[model samples]
Target chain A: MSKGNATKLLGAATLGLMVAALFMVFVYAPAEATQGDVQRIFYFHVPLAWVAFAAFAITAVAGLFYLWLGYPVFDQLAYAAAEAGVVFCTLVLVTGSLWARPIWGTWWTWDSRLTSTFILWLLYVGYLALRAALADGEQGARMGAVFGLVAAADVPVVVVSVRLWRTIHPAVLVTREGSHGLADARMVATLLVSMVAVTAVFGWLLALRVATLRAEARLRGLAAELLALERASEEN
Target chain B: MRAMAAVLLKDVVVELRGPMTTTALATVSLLVLVVLVFAFGPVWGQSEPTAAAGALWVALVVSGTLGGGRVVAVERERRCIDALVLSPLDRGGLFVAKSAAAFVFILVAEGFSLIVALLFFNLAADAALARTAAVLALGAVGFAGLVTLVGAVGGRAKGRDFLVPLLAVPLYVPALIAGVKASADALGGARLGEIALWLKVLLSCDAIFVAAGLLLFEQVVAGSE
Candidate 1:
């Protein structure tokens, strides 16, 4: 199948699953007696967090590939993944904060998870800023790739922050006992569906971003070639 | 290794002869004390001894971060970092040397800051307080190492002054929390074993950041250049 067709399929699947998940969340899934409607936010919030983590992980792996292989494509892929990860991570923070407001009685807390997420946001923002600051393309990509890998090393720090420090926020999804412990069968089914849907959306978004980057690169290369030819003609 | 030590010794001698960096660090420490005094005036007056320990530790961390954060920018602006990189010395060695220099600079600054805090806040002289200073030293070394590495990376970026703190502070949180808790316990006359967990956490963080900085220094320095 063509790239465009694959993107369309992914996009459709994402939309379909999103609709199904929403219906299941509101209608089929029972609302928590404790959190009530706010509990529903978990369906989207948790999946977005998962997608964000997956995106950063992919970016880091791609960065390692770029450094090892010296392939511009891998660098491009890493850049695209980092951008998507930042976006999703930002969404997770905003939605999580909003969800916390009524339940936790505050919009923000110094809980380990919240603090780690905030740090991750800063790391990626700095990553993008570093790229923007560089005048040389190769230099920018190499610098960003290095930073991407280094920043990815901090992921474990973020993951363990909750366990190491005292936090008011309970581990909702991925507990020490695993997801199987906290979530019942029906909740698990809904969560799994949501995760699949979110993953599809993430894939579609990354493909589009990668395609755009590739197109931009091609245009730049063509322009450089054209300039070289013009200079040769003038010399003749 | 000798070349790296030579560079480290050069930085130390420069700091000693001119003492500008050390003086600046001392000044920042004084400024931190003033801020803490003002912010926690009532608490400062009521619990001067206890507050002094906490304030001193904080001053040390902040001053150290600022000093270390400028290490690369100063070298780069002088075009010395390029020369250093071009030399036969290993990049990891350069990182170690810089971090060591930073650690010592911060220790001196913290020493001066502690004196200032004691003078002004009238903190009691106690064995526990002495041990707390030692713990602060360990914490400073770790903090300086991490910040120096980050500073080297951020120095080449735009808004580096802004970026360095943004990137460094979050990473330093765990260390800061652990260090502060350990120091607090020690200052309160608690046994070292009482704060053993926090001490272990600080040591682990120090090891991790040092290893990471050493391993990644070449890439960051070369790429930035």
Candidate 2:
């Protein structure tokens, strides 16, 4: 259907799924025997992290396409995805911190996964800062695309190296071994639903942001066209 | 191959004639080392080898950022990039040449930093020093590739000097981690076999950066009318 209808449908789906996911997290999923209520954060935390990674992946792919095809839409999509990715990534870190404070007795640790996630956040911030520094133009788009691709390429390496670094250096705090051993099926169901819910939420937000960016680009194009027309008329 | 060599030789000849970039790189790294010594001097007894390795890498990265951009920025200042772009040379070949030049500069700078670290940290000049140099060389390969491409990417932008570090630093994390660990192990009297995994990580990081630089450099520096 139309773009607006698709967005509305996405918004409705996201709202429904989010509400269901919340209910499942709070009322359906049973708490862990050891960690108690704080364990419940896993449902949201894992999904947020998943969506954040997915969003960044989308940004990289969009950037790749923009670089290859020189399409403005791809550039816009990349920018929007990067923006959404950063927001979700931040939420993942904040939620992780909140959970850590209660469960690990510290707000943060230099664990492998945690350290890589922080690096991922920094990569996103760096991408955004570069984009902000350069005004909207062909050069900026190309630069941003190149940066996104390079950043995405480094993710696996970052994960591997950080994990290696952590293993070599003795951990300051003891992390839960086998962190995701969902003994209860309800917990699985909740996690799966939460994943879908967060994905939908990300989709809705991405669509809205892309639409706004497209409109802005169009306005800029029209303004440039108007200036050209005025200049031509004055010369005549 | 000839075009790449020509570009590489041009950069080398220019730097050799007036070694401003190399001198600046060495000085910046030296200053960074001195600053690190002051900061970590009090805790020297805690982890001397680790502190030395960490300080050296920090200097490498900070100076690497400063030197990396000069490769492209110099060409830009002389308005030579456009001529080079218009030349018949392959863009990928050009990438190889520029990164190779950057590699040489960063290696020189790292070498100076190593000597300074030796003095500041009071580490013995022995086999461990040799191993540390080897690790620094590997780290420089990856860093040279990264900082070169990032420099070109940021070259056309406003405040690109700031953009270079902002974009390269995070991308350089894996290298930093692997480099620091390998160097620390080397300095701590560990065998090459012990830090083989980290060295492999550095090599892989180098491959990724160089390969990506080859693929993306054209788009990043494609001059527009």
Candidate 3:
């Protein structure tokens, strides 16, 4: 299938899954006794966090490929993924904060999880800002790729920070005790479904964004070629 | 190696002769002091000597970031970066020399700031002061090296003034955490071994950044050209 066809299929699948997941969240999944309806936001919030991290990881890998192979396609893909990652990361922060306000009684806290997410958000925002501000295309990609790879070192650091700092936020998925909290079959199944659904959505968004960036690059290249031709003709 | 030495010496000589950069460094140090006073004043009163020691290191890192950014951004602005790239010296060696120059400059600034902090805050000399100074040196070296590479990359960017910090600060976190822990231990008069964990973290980060910078420097410079 063509890229467009694949994208369309993926988009359709994403919308379908998202609707199904939302229904499951509100109507099917049982509410926690400790937290009420607000807890349902976790279905979307956690998925957003997962997809954001996945997008950044992809950006880093693409950056490495661009540096190694000097491929413009890889650079463009990395840029697109970083942009998408920032959007998802912002969603995670906002939704997480919203959930926290009702449950934790505070909109913001410097708990390790939230702090690391905030830092991650800032890193990508800076990444996008750097890309937007740079004028030279090739040069910008080179710089951006380097920054992407370097900045990615934070992912693992962020993952390990809570362990290092002994902070309040629980490591919901990583730690053994936290895993026990989700031992319920229904909860685990629902979370897994949500993860898959969000991953599919991220893949779909990335495909569309990459296609758009490639089209823009091609237009710019053609414009540069035309400008060169005009200059040559005038010289003649 | 001698070529690298020459590059390093040239930067040091230029800096020594003009001293504008040093004065700027001092000014940044003062600004850090003011900022720290504001940040920590509520918790530990501005008159507390120990707080000043901790705050001094924070100031050093901030000033180091600004100074490191200027080192390469200045070269790019003057159209001299291309000349540097075209020179026969090894690209990795160039990275090392520039990073060394930045490291030394920051160390000097940190030393001056420490003295200022001691005087302003009435800190008494203790074993902790020595240990804290050593940790600051290690952290400063690593921080300067990383920021130098970041600044070089940012120099080729369109909004370098904005890009350098965005690229550098997040990377500075591990170092900042380690530096603060080490400083706190020292200020509390702990043994060198007491802060060994933080020291190891700083050392590992330093080694990683230096290696990455060396490996990536040529690609970054070539891409800039």
Candidate 4:
């Protein structure tokens, strides 16, 4: 009923779902005929990609809300999404890299998906870093909101450019496309389950982060008030 | 129109008068080319058009980051950004004007870099230079457009020199990839139509970046006070 109770319930539910998803990923998802167990990473990897994009989309939507309403709550929402988005984006790159090493035989490549994901990672990593560097006030929030918008806008452009770039340069290997992953019903089921589970994880992280930021803001406000009271008492 | 021109004109006049930023940009660009010399060492010669294209664009990107980061820095330093922000001109106009000026300045620096490349790389001299120029110009516009926004955002944020480039350069990735390939095609004397796709991609990048800066610049410059 209470807000705290609701968060705890959500947290416990997501944690359970994620544990089940992990089981599905490692056990339920049958290994590919070609790539073997290495192909199993796809279950988690695809969901990470999905959730990261979703998180970034949240940042953009929340930022627009902040801009239109001049509300700090929306800004806080954007900040939470941006921070979580960066973490997921980093995992996407790392998972993609790990997947690539076993399959593509390289640590990294300029493939369309990987390239766009990398660019997305860089933009938001910078966003979080920039927010940290700014004065923790309305100015920081406003600037961060703008950065969120810019990063969101670039996602499509990066995808298109990377696709074009990939076409110009031959695709060395096609993995994780419709041909392989979708054909197997178990793999498909595993992927679907993981996507739901990972999304729940995203929601959990976002809510927790937003709450933490709010508490920090409150602490800062209380500190300022305490200082003011001290100054007033000294004068009296 | 008058206000936009004034912003552009002031940037040009200041750069022409002092040439400090240009000098710094030129020096860094030249240094990058020198590093390319190591890349294209004994086996690779100046006649390598592909290598030349790669080197030229990397040099351009490096210099552009350093130069472009200063777009808002100069304004912030003189506290002229406050003046610009307070001006009656719409934020979109200011963004367009600032981008135009930065684009032209980058082009100038790239032109000088081209000349230096000609001497160092012994690049192809014929019809390809024209296409290379086109690719460079389009790429510069796109690069400047996005970087100016980054500069504004980063400059206004707390003191982090690397922040703008880190944030902006990734966005610049699409343009850079398109430009490098297009430039390489041009240097190879590939037909205009052969490179048409790259040109189109570059144009779209330029358009999107300009539109983005125009639309979002107000948000970036608007004070939260």
Candidate 5:
């Protein structure tokens, strides 16, 4: 199949998987004993968090690869992934707060996970800002790649430090680990299927974003060539 | 190694030759401490150490932000950045030289700030004080490594005075949080082991930022766009 067709197929597959996931999340998975139905947000929230991490991992790896190989394409990949990562990270925070408000009786708390997530958001937002603040070509890309790699590499340290800084997380108040250890096979399957679905969606969004960037770069190149020709003709 | 040492030695010589950035920040640090003292409502109270810790870190961070980026700025202002870029020194070695030199200046300013903080706040001069000093040293290493690199890029921006702090502070949060906590623990008479986690954070941050500075120094110190 052609590349466009393949992309179309992937999108359709994501949609199908998402529909299946919605069924499993609502119909298949059993409600928790304590939190009841609001607990269902866990499936989406956790998967979104996972995708955020994965997206950032892609950004970091691509950034480092760009630095080593000096390829504009790698930098492009890193930038695209960072944009997607930031979007997913925002979803993670919003969904997490939503979940927290219903179950933890508060809209927000300075728990380690939440705080680390917030900082992760800040770092990437800073990454985007730094990218914008610099030259728009290879120089900016190079600087951004450096910042991306450094910031991503520092994430583990951030998590550890934040956790050490605050130990009283709401996780202690209520258990949300692996379906609350409910051991219900259907519930487990639902969580797994949902994770797969969102991950697929994440992939699709990443590809779309990258393709847009690539096209934009191509157009910019064409425009620059046209302008250069125009200037030469005028000078002659 | 020789190139790196030469770069460092040059900075020290240049600094010692004149008052430059350090002397200016010393005065600023003292003024900041006075403001902090007033805000904390007299530091000689029962909770002086607690207030003193905050004052100390803020002073250190402020002084650090002002002085950290200026070394590179002065180089740029004097067209020394171009010379340094053209030099035969390895970029990583240049990074090492710059960060090491920046760390020394930062240490001096921090020492002065610490004295100012202690005298004004009337902080205790016991074992806890020694521990806090150690925390300051460890934290400064990481802070210096980061600000040196950040300052290199940030000092080039049109709004560098703002940009340098904007770039440096986010990266400094982890170290600052850990350092402040550890300082509090020390001042509260907690044993070293009890504050081990905070110390670990500081150590890891220091190591990571130093290694990162070394690796990415090439990108930072590259020729103009």
Candidate 6:
């Protein structure tokens, strides 16, 4: 019923799902016939990528609302979502690198998806930096909103152009034998569970960050009111 | 349309009076090409077409960020942006005028850069050069639109000269990748039809940046923080 109870329930659910996901990934799912243990990172990697993209979408949508409605809350939501998105994006890059080094035989490749994801990471980092650089007020928020909207629009083009670029000059080291597909039902189930678990983690993290930002905004508003009241009382 | 043209004329007149933005763009682009020549092992015609194409684009991006932001930054010197915002001109028209001015400046700079690239990289001056020039022009359209939009905010902040490139470069990646590939193909004597896909990407990027700039420029310059 209460907000605190909802958050506690969310935490408990996230913990339970993470435990289930870990067990299913290591114990329930069978190893691949080819790539073996290294392939297991896909469970975490794919979900992290999914959640990061989703988080950025939230940031952009929230920014849109902030601009349209002129609300501080929406700006706070955008900032919180961007922070969480960056965390997940960083993990995606790391797990991807770990997987790539053993499999693709390189620490990094300019593959379309990898390159798009890297650019996405850079764009959001720029977003965060822009916010940090500007004055903390309506103007900063509006500028951030505009930037978020434009960055979101830029992403698909990035994906398409990078794909075209890579395909035009295919890398020599790509030894992929087949599609990255799961042929087994058990693997599918494990991936499904992992996806749900990671998403739950993201939801929980986003809520916590948003709440902290809201509270900070509220505190600043109250402090300003207090200062005004003190000044009035002193004059009286 | 008349208001947009008038604003554009104002920008052009100012630019021609001083020629600061165009001069900066041309000079910086040439310097970047010189740096790239050194970095890429200055082998003249022996170097691949891709290397030369890549170098030219790097020049465009580096100098475009430096000079394109100035297109709007120039408005901030005497608080001219506040006056413009309060003027009867439509915000979208303002965006279009600024971007168009940036587009022309970039084209001029690109012309200089391309000529230097031909000599520094030792490329032929035939149909291939024309095709490459066309490709660079299209790429400039998108870059100009983007830099103009970002310049509004990037110019207002502290340490803005650094801020402009920081904010624009990542968003410019798709255009950079597409432009370099298309130019390289053109330089390699490939027909225009062969690089249609890359050209399409550039066109799409141009459309999105222009559209986004039109829609968001109002909020970007609405008020002083």
- lDDT of candidate 4 over A1-236, digit per residue (tens): 98778789999999999898999889877778888888788788889989999888998899888888987788888999988888888888888889788877898987777777888888888888989989876778888888888777777878898898888787787744753445688888888889999999999888888888888888888999999999999999
What is the C-alpha lDDT profile of model 4 across B4-92, one tens digit per residue? 99999999898989987778778888899989888665767544777778888998889988887687788888888889998988999
Worst 10 residues of 5 chain A by lDDT: A168-177
RMSD of each: 3.6, 1.8, 2.8, 2.3, 3.1, 2.0
TM-scores of the models, in the order given = 0.88, 0.95, 0.93, 0.93, 0.88, 0.95
* Fraction of native contacts under 8 Å reproduced by each candidate: 0.21, 0.82, 0.50, 0.84, 0.43, 0.82
- Hey, what RMSD does candidate 1 come out at? 3.6
Q: On residues A11-43, what C-alpha lDDT tens digit does candidate 6 reach at each position?
A: 999999999999999999999878898889989
| lDDT (10s digit) by residue, model 2, range B11-118 | 999999999899999999999999988887997896999999999999999999988778988998888998888878888998999999999999889889988888
What are the per-model DockQ values?
Answer: 0.40, 0.76, 0.59, 0.73, 0.53, 0.80
lDDT of 1 by residue, A26-88 (tens): 887777666677777788888999998888888889888877888888988888888999999
Clashing residue pairs in candidate 3 are none
Better of 3 and 5 by DockQ: 3
lDDT of 2 by residue, A1-236 (tens): 99999999999999999999999999999988878888899898999999899889988999999988999999999999999999999999999999889778889888998999999999989888888888786777888899899898899999999888888788788766766589999999999999999999999999999999889889989999999999999999
DockQ of candidate 1, scored on C-alphas against the true complex (2 decimals) = 0.40
Least accurate stretch of 10 residues (summed lDDT) in model 5 chain B? Answer: B151-160
Q: Write the per-residue lDDT of candidate 5 for residues A76-174, one digit (tens) a residue.
A: 889988888899899999998898887777888877778889989888887777776776677777888888887887888888888776763335454
How far is A41's C-alpha from truth in model 2 (Å)?
1.5
Position B136, candidate 1: lDDT:
86
Which candidate model has the greater DockQ, 2 or 4?
2
lDDT of candidate 1 over B1-225, digit per residue (tens): 899888889889988798877888889899999998889877545555557767887787677767777666778988899888987889899999888888888888888887787677766677887888888888887787788888876777778777777667766766776777677677777888887877877886788778878887887788444
DockQ: which candidate is best? 6
TM-score of chain B of 3: 0.93
Of the pair 3 and 6, which is ahead by TM-score? 6
Predicted model with the maximum lDDT: 2
Candidate 5 on B60-156: residue-level lDDT in tens?
7888888887877888888888888888998888888888888888788778888877777667678888888888889989988888888876665
Residue-level lDDT tens digits of model 3 in A1-236: 99899899999999998887877777777776566667778888888999998889888999999999988899988999999999999999999889777766678776677777887888888888888888636788888888888778655654454345544335333321341255356666677788888888888888998899889889989999999999999999
Docking quality class, candidate 5: medium
